[model samples]
Target: MPHLTIEYSPNLGDFPEADMALALNASVCASPEVKDESDLKTRFVRTRHFQIGTADTPRAFVHAQLRLLAGRSPKAKQDLSERIAAVLRRMAPRPDGTLVQLSVEIVDMDRPSYVKESLG
Candidate 1:
């Protein structure tokens, strides 16, 4: 199972959360470890108030955390993270004069402790 959460600064203008989620889900599902695309879940959150250290310069950021059930090799995790980072970079908007930093982190969820339910 893959759970993704993308947090972005509010100043990032007309953020396309839905489109980003679609792209990210596709990227994650491409992995051999992922059994089905429907198993991937993503949600976006906007940070209403954030600060970039002491720098007053116009800066923004979009950070994504991808959580997966533990057991994958290190290389697999790294590659999966890299794929997501590339997708985030492509989707992130380069606003005029705004320093935007995009990043992704891969978190391993305890497989035994994780639970999911699919209901109709």
Candidate 2:
């Protein structure tokens, strides 16, 4: 099970937020290994501002975190991370030259209390 959470600056309007969520969810569900759509959950959070290094950039910065169940092999994790980053870059291209930080974390469901809830 993997839970994908996308947190971005509120500069992105409702339409962009909804579009990004759908794109990310589709990317994850498109994974060959993911059998059930219900197993994939995506949440989007829009913040007022996000500090990047010392300077606060006006451009919106998108950070994505994908938390997966523990049993997945290291190779799978790396592949998933690459796929997620690729999808984000394709979806959230920067108007400016600033970079979008995409982070991926794979958590073990056994050691942690990660639950697989419906994506309703």
Candidate 3:
């Protein structure tokens, strides 16, 4: 299973969370390294209190943390990270004066320690 968490500064203004989730899910599923699209889970967290570069001016950032099962090669992970950043950057809102930064981090989970159960 792959879990993606998005954290952003609320000062960036209203964000289309649903659209972002859908777009990110599609991006994650596009990668061949991801085994199942159904196993992907995504969520967004908005931060109200955050400082950027010690500046009082308005600055926005979108940070995505992706967690996947351990096994993928370093190159695969790097590619996935780049793809994710591209998708996010394309969708991120950039106001005339606000500086927006997009970033992604990929983390591997220990297969033995990771557990999942679904009942339908």
Candidate 4:
């Protein structure tokens, strides 16, 4: 199972979080790193109070943390992250002079410690 958590600054007004999630899921589904698309879990968390650089300068950021069970190759991980970043760049528009930053972080979870039981 791969759980994707998307965090972003609150300044991203009218952000296409849902659409971005769908696009991301589709991208991941096409990757060889994942077994199935249905196993993906995604959510977005908006940062209400935060600052980057000068207080007056307009800045916004979207960070995606993807957690997966250990055992994937380093190349696969990098590919996934890069694919995600590309998607973010295409989906998340950068406002003029907003200094928007998009990043993706891949986290490897201990396979033995990770537990899950899907209910149908």
- lDDT for each residue of candidate 3 in 3-101, tens digit (9 for 90 to 100): 999999987777878998998889889999877889999999999788889858878899999999999999999988987898788888787798898
Q: Distance from true position, residue 34, model 3, in Å?
A: 1.4
| Residues 2-119 of candidate 4: C-alpha lDDT, one tens digit per residue | 9999899888777898899999899887888888888888898998798887788889999999999989999999998987898889988677889898889999999987889977
Cα lDDT tens digits for candidate 1, 1-120: 788899999999999898988888888899887898888889999998999979789999999998998899999999889878988899988899999988889899998878888887
Each prediction's Cα RMSD?
1.1, 3.3, 1.2, 1.3
In order, the Cα lDDT scores of the candidates are 0.89, 0.69, 0.88, 0.89
Per-residue lDDT, model 3, residue 110, is 98
Give lDDT tens digits, candidate 2, residues 1-120: 677877776554442667877777787788775778777778877776567677755555677778766777888777777777777777775555555565555555664775555466
Clashes of each: 0, 1, 0, 0
Any residue pairs clashing in model 4, and if so which? none
Per-residue lDDT for 73 in model 4? 94
By the TM-score metric, which is better: model 1 or model 2? 1
lDDT of 4 at 67: 94
**Residue 115 lDDT (model 4):** 83
Measured on C-alpha atoms, candidate 1 has an lDDT of 0.89
